[model samples]
Target: MTEQLSTTFNSLREAWLQHRPDERQRREDLLRLRSAFKASLPQMTEAISRDFGHRSAHESMLAEAMIVLKEIDHCLHKLKKWMKPQRRKAGWQFWPAKAEIRFVPLGVVGILSPWNYPVNLSLTPLISAIAAGNHVFLKPSEHTPHTNAYLTRLLHDCFPQNRVSIIQGGADIAAAFSSLPFDHLFFTGSTAVGKKVMAAAAKNLTPVTLELGGKSPALIAPDADLTKTVSRILTGKLFNAGQTCIAPDYVLLPENQLETFIAECQSQTAQRYNEANGQTDYTAIINESQYKRLTGLADDASIRGHKVIPLLSLNDTQKAENRHILPPMLVINPDDDSAIMQEEIFGPLLPVKTYRSYDEALRYIITRDRPLAFYIFSSSNEPVENALSNVVAGSVCINDTLYQFACANLPFGGVGMSGMGHYHGEEGFKTFSKVMPVLRKYNPAATDYLRPPYGRFADTLIRFLTK
Candidate 1:
């Protein structure tokens, strides 16, 4: 096994050395990969549903298929321009010399994908890496083994393994994979895991783009329209059963309007889903562990005197044995020390906290490191602008959440504990390439400021310009 692993690594290194694939080849491969990916969508949905036990097919299409296809198209539309060598202005000292920036591809990239967004999270980065003219090694989440296997096979059928490979295993294999010194690394996971991945990449001084998650908050000011607020909040939470990195971790509401927000949210939740048994419009959690973890947060809050309401009420007996299923839960008066509040609630539980005023809510969010994404739901433009201007999250949404990630033109990633660096859009190309600045010498007579005679005139000229 070690011999094969070493051989594979050596092969990739050789491929990277030999890779001078032209623009035409890159486009052809991308188009072929696109067709293969599109063909697998139906099966991908099935594997995701089997992995989560009740993943909504429609939700999968909206979240995964729509976004991935749009990204593919976005890259294809702009790839030619993005691949062109950009002309840069030469300084006055090099008046006759030409300067330009070329977008050279990184040799090989190792992408560690998260389970929450198994398809788009994994494949979208691949698109960027490929578009940037580099080969890739994708490591999808082991938690979704079926999806992982299917992705591997899909790529294998579409392209040669030497150009793109999929490595599958549990944590041990992932640890081993991370230790390898790839040209660049793109990781999408929790903050804790992101730290480890960053440290591993540091061993080889490999540049990385970490897309970690934080407790992203959504604020609803007093002047906000309640109907719109409820609809947007519920839509954000219901998507992927709230297992999204940018999903609103919690909501801040006006003090007296807390009950009204909860009631409206409850109504909005039911309107999105059918009340029939096991026939939910929303998707399910990834596994029992996630389900239990989500329920534990609710149970902890409920035991601590906070009011917990399942927006879609259910029978007690059926609910106990259920896996991968949880009605939208809203926790009222959740304290700071509660587990749900402390951790990134990557589940369907929404904690409601009442702020004394708009400034109070703003203060709470500013105290923490900026989140990957922050959202504000208000009819008036002032509060929305206030939140966007004040908070330092990676991306801000007005009266919505998680939609920024869908726009192929927008750069997606995080800041601080949420993550470091970004990928997506043109930034994706920059992330995978090293921007080297070059300057050429012009006519000797014109560049005589540094003739090195150790004279006062030369020193004065150098000091005048450089200083």
Candidate 2:
């Protein structure tokens, strides 16, 4: 085991040193990876579906495969500008000298990806690292064995193992992987595990970027259209059965519009997922354990006097035999201390809380740890601006959820308890890179007057510059 780990690390270091890629080479390699991804779209979809038991192929294509395709395009298009050295003005003390910022590649960046959206989460960072000219060592989650296996084979066809390698294993391997001294570490998982990863990386002094989950909230304003907002909210929450890290954890709606909001949400969910016996489009919980945990949360809330309503009642067969296919549920005004409210519900279960005013809604969110993402579905800008300014979330989307992560131009990450740092597009490149400030001197005699003596001319020059 020690030999295996050391071998992988040493190979990455040697590969990184053997060939430091320039902008043209980086773009060409990205294009090659891009073509490979597009060609294997069908296989990639099937692999993720097998991992999740029953993930929608359409969802997989859009969220996992195609998103990476677009990201590759974005990188290739912006590579020259991103790689260009940024010139800085020389100060009065160093007049006539040139100063610039150069983005240097960090060797052997370690990537720790999660099961949810494994393809995108794993390769998107890889894309950024490759663009920044770093050799990558990725460790995908063990839960998605099928997808990870496919990823291993697919990446093998594109590049040599020494350049960008994928390591697969369970928790023990993961613990050991985190402790390795990589140039940088990028992790995506739950907040509890994120803390541990951060601690482990600290021992190596490895700079880290953690993309973690929390109880992200969706707030509705008075002037918003329930028709459009409710439909979008349903899509966001039900997508991947709410397995998304940035999915709306809870809804804060107007007190007077509670019943109408609930009715509209249920209606939209049924419309989008119109299946009687079982939901073919609806994603299942990853496994039996996840299903039980989600059910436990719903059951605890139900027992504690919270109104638990299934968007669509599943047959006994679907509920009993097909337990992994968890039905969408709405919890009306769950108690603040309940598990549904306290814990991050990473399934198709959403709690709808009512507030009298915007202040009340904002207060409820502020009292908790800063979330990964926050949303407001308002036509007006005042409430959106207020929430964006007051809230300290990692990212905010006014009138939307989860789409911010799709944009390669935007930096996707968390703040506070949600997690730390960001990695997407240029930010991802910057995260995996060491930016060094370079100073060039054209004339040696430019500093001769102030070098040794601190004489009259030096004093006069200092006074002149200061004045």
Which candidate should be chosen as best, given TM-score against the real structure?
2
Model 2 lowest lDDT segment of ten: 314-323
**Cα lDDT, model 1, residue 80:** 89
Q: For model 2, how does the per-residue alpha-carbon lDDT over 1-467 read when each residue is reduced to its tens digit?
A: 65687789899999889988788778878988988888998889899988888888889988987789888988888888888899999775786688999999988889999999999999999999999998888999999999998899889988888888988898888888889889999999998888889899999899999999999999998888888888888888999999999999999999899889888977888777765635678888998888899999999998998999899766665566566888899999999899998889999999999999999899888989999999898988898888887788988888877899888889988999998888888898788778999988777545765778578888888788889
Task: Give the local distance difference test score of model 2.
Answer: 0.88
TM-score of each: 0.95, 0.96
lDDT of each: 0.83, 0.88
Leading candidate by lDDT: 2
Q: Give candidate 2 misplaced runs (Cα > 4 Å).
A: 276-278, 316-321, 444-446
